[model samples]
Target: MKMRFLAHFVALILFPCWFVSVRAEEIKSPQPCDFKALFNFGDSNSDTGCMASAFYPEILPYGETFFHEPVGRASDGRLIIDFIAQHLGFPFLSAYIDSIGTSYRHGANFAAGSSTIMRQNRTVFQGGTPFTFEIQVAQFNQFKNRTAKFFNQEKENSFTKDIPRPEDYAKAIYTFDIGQNDIAAVISQSGMEYSHAVISEIVDNFTSQVQYLHELGARTFWIHNTGPIGCLPVAMPVHNAKNQSLVAGYLDLNGCVNYQNDMAREFNKKLKNTVVKLRSHYPDASLIYVDMFSAKYELISNANKEGFVDPSKICCGYHENGHHVYCSNRAIINGKEIVPGSCDDPSKYISWDGVHYTEAANYWIANRIVNGSFSDPPLSIAQSCHA
Candidate 1:
């Protein structure tokens, strides 16, 4: 009792501003989670640079809106993972494959562009990451094992400057924002019928990775359900809808492909159930399920009302006939080399290049999600510790 009172007295003396809050439990602390680091696994939605480093590096107009140069992110600016890092009061995570400007002091990102829960294809040339969820899980294990060796030898290792502390592993937050590409791949390769039926298998693959993380000493997990791929302009062309050849259904109210959105909705439902099932399996862990579908759907469904152009509009890239020219990519137009380039103001748009969201749209979605409105446990990122 004396120690508790003395600690309060010292706090009152050191900080007199909000120290005298009306109630002890009412304080909205910055990070009640107090997560030491962030370890993320996902696709392009959360990928920082792994795919770019291993495959093709981006150029101008990719990160022009924020970084003023290519930094490997597909968006015009930061992604939701960047915003989540800010909410955690930590620096943005570095890709495990990107060696330059990297410091694992906070954590590392194993996400890659076009990643899927189930293994799809090899390399960006093949159109998706070979680094599937299980592969990323193996990479994470390797990282954790190797970094620990360097940290243990810090006394003799001058290169241990940016390595994460050994203790932070348990105190870190592990996030997953993948699984969209899996459905897309199946839909493109097979048909809508197989994609609809294979959702359970997809969830099963995702669950195995989470179980591995828990076994590897991961305590807190933040899982984001897949978003509305039906709304993406890049995804629209792939849909059999426009031609009414594959799935016979009209576009939804939001001008999105109905079948694609249905796939995302079904995936989210099963993913949520997977989280619930895992919570019982790992009684000592904190598994948080965040509903990214609703949050992203909200933005896409109301892009114009929130001071932005149509959600289906592309801020960067050009479509010449059937060939799509993404931002900073070269194309021969009329027998001339040309880059379609980006818009004059990316902030006014939602989709960055017909696929990913712009920094503005990302920020808007981040604001709504970090507040806990879409979280399964109904807790903000800051308050995820309890959940």
Candidate 2:
């Protein structure tokens, strides 16, 4: 009986992996299309080369897994933004601080790691300049400015005198992935009441930001849904209790934190509905909402069931209370020079630190997006190449 039970358990474990691999193999690769450039906005999950350099050198350890050094990513390696750009056959968009002579003929990255949808959310998240959605619009204007100069230089050399208008100079693929920080910061800084208010109030602010971008000639939009917040390790200590953690509120029939998980669901539902309404609001706008929430849950929930050993704990964190303290300094621990600890193979783990995913996890989510699994009505970026 015991041997048969073990055999059944092993088969159950192996089946999901085989299933996911087969599904991955079945996905059609992206074909090159008509988008001249790609522009990214929002927080760290999509930030490729904007956050780490602008903030702190200690950010190195965070990207050590895949990048080997700080490449201005929030995770330990490539982010979803990089994957999307690569899928489109464009070079990784240069950071504003990089001063590299890259072809902006495509677009530029305006994403900053701790950015928010609302300007006020910055103060709530602690340090750094508030690269609000409004500011991202301004950065797009700068990109348009640079593209105009490139065209004007070409015109100066030719006989043609037709100047490209701002609209003509702008041909882009725009992505917005903000708002989680705004929701998170509300709880981190203000009371829960403020968090609830932010949940309701930011809908209009988000709509306005999208509308503003549309007015600026941004037509191809990839709006990402909010990622799972209750699952983050940082929240573990914050929501800890004697009997259980707030994360317990997301469990299925297993006495887990279903209620907390539902909070994330509620947020995604509203955002999804808003996307539907926004599509109706602007007939010319081709806005696609990407549901990262469900996909993130797919990777995170039962992480142990998916080959990760430690789901509740971070790779590097304070051992006492399960809190994250910067593990930057290579100090002596019991006479050995140690920077505390880091995950052996970050690719195997879904999370890098307490709050974010490993590069491999980001790749998985991007693969899901590219495969049209994350999109409503399944609109792949490859399909929008003609847009």
Candidate 2, pairs of clashing residues: 34-385, 37-106, 248-256, 248-257, 249-257, 249-258, 250-257, 250-258, 251-256, 251-257
lDDT of 1: 0.84
Residue 133 local lDDT, model 1: 90
Candidate number with greatest lDDT = 1
Local distance difference test scores for all models: 0.84, 0.68
Q: Where is model 1 more than 4 Å wrong at Cα?
A: 1-31, 121-127, 154-156, 190-192, 237-249, 333-338
* Candidate 2: segments with Cα more than 4 A from true spot: 1-33, 100-103, 121-128, 153-170, 189-191, 237-260, 302-305, 327-338, 385-387
